[model samples]
Target: MGESIVITSGKGGVGKTTSTANISVALANFGKKVVAVDGDIGLRNLDIILGLENRIVYNLVDVVKKRCRTKQALIRDKKNENLFLLPASQVDDKSAVTPEDMKELCSELKEEFDFVIIDCPAGIEQGFKNALAGADSAIVITTPEVSPVRDADRVIGLLQHHEIPASLILNRLSVQMVERGDMMSREDVEDILAIKILGLVVEDQEIVNAGNLGTPAVLNQNSPAGQAYLRIAQRILGENVEIPSFEEKKGFLARLLGR
Candidate 1:
């Protein structure tokens, strides 16, 4: 059976969707049949990030409403035959689907793929619950900021409430900022969130450019974030890969804060 995983964060713009898209592609590249489900509902962009938006005709809502078959709604990746996308509806409201529906869809998808990754929407609301309901594991993404760390902590607590095993993905870390005592280090983020580090994606403009071009950074081998995401995907597949730190040093302030 396939594994269902949700990439989520309580705060928006913390690289949840990007991580989902990239990791899904990376997993597919590893010869795994992967299906990425956009659980963002009204604000769906997983399709765009995967560069499959233009090919989407039927979405998740269409499948739920029996307007189309699941196979028909799934958009196959142009580059990887094993990678598919189940996009969220643009016209429908967020309340159109429930956690039970997500669970059913995941159960069905599991029979067909090796991995099912859900790109959860921000906040610890219905959308979050729905996205996590069917996930066997979760990737909680955050940034180096204290606010994002706090929000990630809250999300971790909620995931624990649901009895879901979750790992942390610290995104947008700046090595230079950490050296200058301007940003939080990986240890600082893990210390605050109190979760195992899954991976760290350094701040890279290439990720932004890739997003603009409707392609995930993992598809662009030149991006450091892409390499980091590939490692994350390998880790998710139970590979004993070493997680790297994106910061140069922990810094004096970090050490002082720890004391």
Candidate 2:
């Protein structure tokens, strides 16, 4: 059976949807049949990020309510034939779907796709519970800020309580700030969250531009953020690829200034 992984964060605006979109595309590039599910009902944006917003005829709510077949709700990606998107309902609220409903949907999806990546909503409410219900594993996204890190800790505790295997994806990291003691380092976040690191994404403007253009950054090989997401996908597939160090990317002038 294929694995279902939820990309989630405790607080909002930490790049959960972006991670979902990029990783799904990256996995598709690796020859895997991947489906990206938007679990944030009513506040759904995964479809927009994947550039399938205009193509969504049906959504997760429809599948759960038996209003449409699962296949009918899947929107194929324009860039990758193996990639698909299951968008969330904009009209329905979180109460429209239950945890049981999500579990059944994910179970069905796992049979057909090599990977099911669920883009979970922010907060620890019904949406979060619904997203976690069917996930075999989870990737928690957090920034270097204190609030996001604290929220991530709470999320990790909940994952542990439910016995779900979770990994950390540190997002929007700045190498210069970390070296200058102006921001939290990877070690600092790891020390607090106490989870295995799946990936470290550097701050990049290209990510925003790619989202605005409705293309995942992973499709652009020139983007560092895209390359970082690709590495994360490789690691998820059990590849033995080493994660490149951020320090190594720093300029000589930056290093000298830090010294």
Candidate 3:
């Protein structure tokens, strides 16, 4: 069976959705069938990030309501055929689908795909619970800021309470700021969260540009953030790829210039 993973953050604006879109594309590039589900009802945008916004006819709510079959709601990726998107309902609120419904939907998707990635909504409300319902594993995303880190710590505790395995993905990290003692380092965040590090995505403008253009950063070979996400996908597949040090000034510069 396929693994159902949730990409979540305790707070908004932490790049959780971006990570979900990029990781889904990365796994698809590795020859894995992947489906990304947007768990944020009433404010769905996973389709836009995947560049499949114009193709969404049936959404998650439609499937749950039996208005259409699961296959009818899936939007296949234009770049990678192995990737698909199950968009959330733009009209319905978070209460439209229960946690049990999410579990059943994820289980059904796992039967046909190699990976099911749920882009969870921010906060620990009903939407968060629904997103966590079917996830076998979770990737908690956070930035170096104090508020995000504190929120991530709370999320990790909640995951532990639910007996769900989780790892940390530190996003929007700035190496120069860390070196200058202006930001927290990877080790510092890990120490506070007490979770295994899945990956570290450095601050890169190319990621923003890629998202704006409806292309995932992971598909951009020249992007350092893309390389970091690819390595994370390899790790998810049980590969022992060495994660390069992003703390060094020269190493950061080299990666930024695509060297």
Model 3 segments beyond 4 Å from truth?
248-259
Best by TM-score: 2
Error of 2 at 64 (Å): 0.6
- Model 1 clashing residue pairs (backbone): none
Q: Per-model C-alpha lDDT, please? A: 0.91, 0.94, 0.93
Candidate 3 residue-wise lDDT, 1-259, digit = tens: 9999999989999998999999999999999999999999999988888888999899999999999999999999998999999999999999999999999999999999999999999999999999999999999999999999999999999999999999989999998998777899998898888899999999999988987899999988899999899999999999998877764434656767867
Candidate 2 regions exceeding 4 Å error are: 248-259
Model 1: residues >4 Å from true position, as ranges? 250-259
Q: Between 1 and 2, whose TM-score is larger?
A: 2
Cα displacement (Å) at residue 51, model 1: 0.9
lDDT of 1 by residue, 1-259 (tens): 9999999989999998899899999999999999999999899999888888889899999998889889999999999999999999998877899889999999999999999999999988888988998999999999999888899999999999999999999899988988777888888887787899999899999998989988889878899999999999889889999987444665578768973
> Largest lDDT belongs to which candidate?
2
Candidate 3: worst 10 consecutive residues by lDDT? Answer: 246-255
Of candidate 2, the 10-residue stretch with the lowest lDDT total is 243-252
Give the Cα-based TM-score of candidate 3 against the true structure: 0.95
